[model samples]
Target: MGLSAVPSGPGGEASRTDPAPPRDVAGRGAEAARLADLVARSSRGHEDAFSELYDLTASRMYGLVLRILRSADHAAEVTQEVFVEVWRQSARYAPDKGSVLAWMSTIAHRRAVDRVRSVSSEVARDEQYAVTTVVREADHVWEDVEQKMDVERVRKGMASLTAIQREAIGLAYFGGYTQTQVASLLKLPLGTVKTRIRDGLIGLRDALGVEE
Candidate 1:
């Protein structure tokens, strides 16, 4: 049996194969430029411009909050607080310091840290499992394969440190425990905990090639 030819639509002609339409590249560029201008104006107390800036940056700011907080409920709460802070402090942002995204990320980072620390020590002790869950989730979010590799590199750089120094730093920073808390948890002297944290930070600063 011979294969039947497919029928064309309408005209007695072969169907035309249309090429994909071109994207609105210039439009996107113009929109981004407009948003940047709006943010600049908003930073100077222009209410409408501030609204537009909020629209542009809110999702990105939320993503950062979620990554750090790891609880959708807490993240949402923090996201609102972050924008409120941005609206109040917009005038303090200096373009020379960094881009809008960086400034917003910095704000989110500080706020997340503060929120994490504000959980009272007693509550934190009682809710250790909850804190561990949040930290594990945050590690999954922030330390993907690439970031894990970077962490390994950082660990290698701190190779000169004794096990106690490494553990002290990890508990204080990654575990979000205060020095006194770390000492209590590790059953170490308070002074020893302090020395380990300070020395470990100095060692890590060198290992990670961070400047003073």
Candidate 2:
């Protein structure tokens, strides 16, 4: 490895060599071919191929999911979900559209986003559940059906907001936390948390067709 000079900054980061630069494109093509083959075999129910594929990519995919999720347990769970989907849907991969790693990472990122959305929706559903619990006089059958419908609506509506907005609003409104508390929990500025909550609620309202 050789060092390369970079501009000095407050952190004073130093020069770094880009590894495998000489064969970067060729290496990627070869790697893509290898992974595509593995995916194809895995799709055909080859246990060995799937095992090798996991060995080659699981760490990278887990790291990517962890960064997005910021929770070890959630990240681990979603990482498994991503891999399971990959094995199930491997036949759907099209190299013409992108490289193998690109396809895998896309699945990982989407799964991570879904996990975030699910958490927020679960919070909203919990609130609705509490309401249903308090209103015990209602017909049990209709109440259960209505509760399910409401939770489904929240799931659909929450998807429209950005992940951060959904999370902030969930904490404040559904999780029963104040805006200040949400800010503290998310480690964001109070105004930013407030704005996310506002924007998120507006989006949800529009999705649910709430007037005013």
Candidate 3:
């Protein structure tokens, strides 16, 4: 059939037309399925599958480790350890348990935590403290520029907060005190400390525009 022309509006201009949006759902589903298949194959000693899996997850795993350890060198070391462990334990992964990404995150978290604990222990020992003297000195230098800026921002944010809120946040994050420990340190009731921490975090999140 011959098409009929629609009448133009106002200044004889045709109305603007919008194009259909691209569909990403099928692509994402295919990628997920591919990763699952790769993981399954890697478990059975498929080197190509293992390499592909590593390529997919390495950046994410390294970023996770770096966030926890806060040191590039340590993050690199832990990332290497994580992939080594992943390769060794690939056979232990069960499809029923979780996604491949979740399994990788769990391993990365454990290794990063272990590294932190190990460093803490070494720092606690007097003999090894000397060996870490350089680390301390470097930290002092770095703190003056980078950390000082962070501290100032935190301090400014704290200044905008109630004294109790600032206290709660300081104890929890800087002092590494748990809610119970924070309560103990401040000689406040545990419930009060909990409330303060919750409120403080909310305020900080709002102030910093952190996504919930």
Candidate 4:
């Protein structure tokens, strides 16, 4: 299970303490075993082991967070937080439950989800406060008529989009999901999702007679 480099020989070449295994055979299970060892060593207060663990997992962890949050800044912050938690809770890791990657991914995913909910809650509260504090005045009849017409135009424009384009746009813009998340939710390729959204917006713009 050791993933460390082989010791050097007298001539400074890697010593063959054991025969090399086929990469195709050793790739998947070997990585899992190495990660498990890293976690175990980290739990024993080995900084080097923890550093190796972070190097191995940080990219994947950050990618997962970015996919959920759709913000590089937030993803970087959350990735750092995830490693801190992993270092603090390393001793509590139970390898029987799952692989190290799975456990770490779970922590990263939960942290990202909590951040999304917290931001959403704060935004909602701020919006409610703004609505309550704003002065309400009766609009002129002409103003009301203009607003109604604009609403109808938007509704009709939305209706003009194809079903797939509408669904992608709805999930990305209104439901507040990233394009990658929309692709996963719809079981479509990411490029396909992007195309749908782009096409949908163009259709809406054309229908609304919007310039540029």
Candidate 5:
């Protein structure tokens, strides 16, 4: 429902103010391999491996959901749903497609986004019905139209970003991750992630016709 920072720890646990130490490429690869193996085992009905997978990833998944939903209770429930999907779909995971963490993050992002859109759709329906029941002032009607146009403009602007830039911005803004976390997830350097976000925002501002 809103964007909020959720402090994350090394293993993606939330509520830790300390920044996680950076990992070398080899270290990241090792972690990815570990997660992938766990997934594979879990898919084969290894209960202990599934439990370990939950332990390793739940905190980070919860943080991501919390950032998008801005509600701890909803986040917790969604996090549980995410892992259930993970368990059910673990066999479908392909190491060739991406890291296990990335796979799980995608699932989390989609589930959270779906929840937000569901709520938004319900609100929009109620508003539409209400509109037929009450007459609005001309100016208020114009304001509503303008707001809808602005939202459309913003969506178009986002479509203008380069794939990498769009992805970085999505993780940082919509996915509720810090630049550092984005870099970690993307396996890019911190500075590179910062540049992408900066350039992406500039592009979006220009698209919106906003002056510096």
Candidate 6:
């Protein structure tokens, strides 16, 4: 699907046809294995490995970020941030936790979400603050500790979600977009978006050990 232009930050429009860097997949077999190896080597301070990883995943990651942000330039910037985090946190990645692409995609999603949060309307920002304030007012100690833990649990659980489910939840809750808006942004049917959000929430509830 073709993406429309959204206003960029200080810089002008990002080159939609930016040149792709070289990829080194000589001995790599399956896509998952290739990504895993590059991530492992990158964690061990292999610059070449890191370069290859970027070459392999950057475009796709950038595209995903662009979809969420709706700005080519900001998407490019956030995609850079995502790779920086990937280089820094690759060692912490566990194979049992998820595939390398999924891990990287999670990082991309989070960075894009953060960028969107920063650019979100003041009304939404104030609403988020009000919600936080209310939580703080009720059983301050428990809310503080449990809220942190629950948020972390949900973050972890989010990575395990199907791509559509994860994106739907991120757009609705994190992007401060309504479900209809999320559906529009994602170019998915409203019913599909609703189902993904409902199912994603249920999965997150289980992850947080909340009773159904």
Query: For this target, which candidate reaches the highest lDDT against the unseen true structure?
Result: 5
Candidate 4 ranges with C-alpha deviation above 4 Å: 1-25, 120-212
Separate clash counts for every candidate = 0, 0, 0, 0, 0, 0
Worst 10 residues of 4 by lDDT: 131-140
Rank order (by lDDT, best first)? 5, 4, 6, 2, 3, 1
Q: Which is the winner by lDDT between candidate 2 and candidate 6?
A: 6
Q: Rate the local accuracy (lDDT) of all candidates.
A: 0.67, 0.71, 0.69, 0.74, 0.75, 0.72
Winning candidate number (TM-score):
5
TM-score of each: 0.47, 0.47, 0.49, 0.48, 0.51, 0.50
- Per-prediction CA RMSD (Å): 13.3, 18.0, 11.8, 20.2, 17.3, 18.9
Better model by TM-score: candidate 1 vs candidate 4: 4
How big is the positional error of residue 42 in model 1, measured in Å on the Cα after superposition?
A: 7.5
Candidate 1: give its CA RMSD in angstroms. Answer: 13.3
| Candidate 1 off by > 4 Å | 1-70, 83-87, 93-110, 117-152, 158-160
Task: Assess candidate 6 and give its TM-score to the true structure.
Answer: 0.50
Off by over 4 Å in 5: 1-22, 120-212
Superposed by TM-score, candidate 4 places the C-alpha of residue 65 at a distance from the truth, in angstroms, of: 0.4
For residues 130-173, write the lDDT of model 3, one tens digit per residue. 44445656666755454465455555667777889989987665
Candidate 6 on 1-212: residue-level lDDT in tens?
Answer: 33345465323434434322112122222667889999999999999999999998886697677666766556667888899999999899998887788789888877777677674522233333444445446644564453455456656788878899999988775564778889999999999999999999888766544321
Worst-scoring 10-residue span by lDDT in model 5: 121-130
Off by over 4 Å in 6: 1-29, 120-212
lDDT of 4: 0.74
